[model samples]
Target chain A: MIEIKGLSKKYGSTQALSDVDLQLRPGEIVGLFGPNGAGKTTLIKSIFGYIPYSGSITLDGEPVTRKNITRLSFATCEHSFFPNIDAKAHAQFYKDHFESFDEKRFNVLMEFFSLPKDKAIKHLSTGQQNQFEVIMALCQGADYILMDEPFAGNDIFNREDFYKVLLGMLGPDECVLLSTHLIEEVSGLINRAVLIDKGRIIGDVQLSELEESGRDLMDYIKKSFSYRSDRVFEALDQLVPEEERHEEMA
Target chain B: MKKWLSVLELHAAMRFKRVLLVLGTMIVLQMLSFWILGDQSNTQTFFQVLGKIKYGWIFALGFLAMYWALSWPLGRNETYSYTLQRLSVTERGSVWMKFIFNALCFVPLVIVQAGLILLMAKIFEAGKPFAGNAHGILIDLEKDGMLHALVSFSNPAQVIYRIVYILIATACATHMEVLFARKQTPILSFIPPVILLLINNIWYDEFHVAFAAAIIISVICMITALVRCRGKKPLRDILEQQEV
Candidate 1:
């Protein structure tokens, strides 16, 4: 479980995240949805304590810090493994470094995936590298896992396989916080969704509640943004009469 | 501690190519010096050869130092997304592991080079067919004092001093490299070590002070590097008022 309060991050002239609050419960799989530059990654990083931000982040009620990061595992789309080493060596290194690493589980995952153990990580395809990182992350046996666009480079089969393995590996006590733009693919996988735009949380709704609203995940997302955008247009229209607005448009 | 050590070992193994390249370059330079100076028995030639070899060692040290410094920071791009993902699972020991990994890489290389030199001297002395002052080449082995100096690891005091000195130096070098890489001004990373070397040269007669000063500077640099990395701020934060 994770709690973020009044989280704000600024990048010089641009605000990446502003006054955002979020909470993730154990055994919950939440998908973070946002367009490019929507501060989705910023929010995730801030929660992970990767960057210095004006916010309070607590993991399972404990304040997040460098000392306690071993309790969390993060996987991103990029090749996070040491590119020069083989998969087995990389896994062994992680097993040695992380207190909670589950070597048997990792071996099982690797075996199931049929990931080449001897090939250098650099030689692996982008999708394979992503899989390897995911496998390593899961092996940490941490209670919380954060994934950023884990499906980015994967083929359809690999992506589906990843999701299956990921879900299969999750115990009842584990929670997953995933951020990705592939809303449809992840819609069925996540129990909750957080939509962010322009450094603010635009919507936070349970997937079931969102579904009960009688709209598909994509439709609901589009409608939410459209409704917000329409309010801005309506406010602008109110500043001037419809005739004036029509004349200006003409 | 064992876990951290294992990680360090894996890191060194992953960086095998870079380490091999540095050691290979040093050996080549050593061989080239032997070739150019050509088997002369004159005292001047011996001194000249020794001088070049010493300088060669210094040059190799500099190269290795630079390589060690840049290895982690510049080896990969520091994207916010990537940093966030990595931080999720990373431990503080991960940072310390980098320093230990770099140190472990040089251990075997340095030992093998030193051992081979001593072994070759013994072999030549046993087969005294060519009598052209082979004793001069083997002088370091004959004089226990020089041998002790040459094998710095064998002297407890020297070992402690070198360990502390190299640890600090490497740590600082690594820090400067990260700082420089973040700013995309890697060129400036060389300044700290260069300045330290200059100070060492100026106070060469006071070897104790020079060594201490180098170690102190390296420790300071390492501390600064750790401080800078304490957050997820883009390494470029040091170079400019840029945001990520």
Candidate 2:
């Protein structure tokens, strides 16, 4: 379980996240859907204490700090593995460093993904690297797992296999927060959806509610951004000649 | 204990090739110098050779320290990928543990070098059948007062001083490497260490004073790194507060 409140982040004059709030419960799979630069990565990084931000975040009612972070696991599309280390060695390093690392589970995931154990992480295809990252995170056996764009470079089959492996690996006490642009592929897998645009939480609803509303997740996301586009167009129209606006409309 | 050792092992693995290249280069250069000189005997020649070796060691250590300083920001950024966002207090122990681990790795290397020097002295004495006073080299070292001054500096005091100084340098280097490894402004992390190193060298004539000053400065740096690393707070809180 995690609780985040009034979280805001700024890089120089540009805002990356703005007053967003959310709560997650155990055993829940939440999909964070957003377009490029939608603050999805920022939110995920913030949860891992990788970036500094304003406000409060707590896991199971305990304040987050560098000490207890070992209890959580995070994965991102960005290359984090040591470039020179092969996949097997990287996994071994993780197992040695993290007490909760499940070596058996990691090996199984590697087998499932058909990742080359002897290949240096830097040499792996992007999809294989992502798979390796996913396997590493899952093996940590943390109560909370945060993934940022984990399926960025995968083919459709690899993506499907990843989802299947992820679903099968989830325990009753674990929760996973996956941020991605590919909402359609994971729509059915997620129980809750948090849609963000321009650094704000525009929609946070149950997946069931979204389906019941009969709007596709991708369409809902487009509509959320379209509202801003519409506002901008309206402002532009007000500056245009009346005859020109009418002609354009016709 | 295990986790800290694992961290050290990982650090070594990551920097293994670089360390090997540096040490290998130094050893080869030293061997070449010895080969060209034909043979080294007597206190005068021995001091010259030892002086060169000492300078070589210092240069290598300084290079390592600078490299570590330069890489701090990137290493820190890379480490964040594996770190949990929530700020907790456990990093204090982790930092100290890493400091110890790095010092332990370097200890054997230093001892082996010292042992080789002593063995070289014995071998030189064995080859000269005409030379009656073989122990003169050791006596001369004791008289020139560098070795005596070093050994009798404060009995066990010098060892402690050396250990602490080495630990601080290694710790700071390792921390910097982890902190600055992949950041847009990773060079920012090097500012403090470089500034301190420069300050220590400002009064070049005061070499002894500067060496002591450098040790103190490194200690302060280690403390600063521990504070910054331990106080890391999660980014999620920042995201939630954005006005978007």
Give residue B73's error in model 2 in angstroms: 8.0
Evaluate residue B185 in candidate 2 and report its C-alpha lDDT on the 0 to 100 scale. 36
Q: Which ten residues in a row are the worst by lDDT in model 1 chain B? A: B80-89
Residue range B1-244, candidate 1, lDDT tens digits: 5755675575567666777776676666555555464243442323334444453344446445546633544235333224222443343345567666666654554454556445444443444334324656555433333234345565698567545644655665566545554544444335545544543333333456655666666667666666656554443363124333
DockQ of 2: 0.24
What tens digits encode model 1's per-residue C-alpha lDDT throughout A131-222? 88888778887888888787787888888777777778788988888999888888878888889999999988898886787767777788
How much is the lDDT of residue B25 in candidate 1?
Answer: 63
User: Candidate 2 DockQ category?
Assistant: acceptable
Give the DockQ (2 decimals) of all models: 0.26, 0.24
Off by over 4 Å in 1: A66-68, A97-100, A227-250, B36-45, B48-74, B78-97, B104-131, B138-168, B177-189, B192-216, B229-244
> What root-mean-square deviation over C-alphas does model 1 reach?
6.4
Which candidate leads the pack in lDDT? 1
- Give per-residue lDDT, candidate 1, residue A3: 90
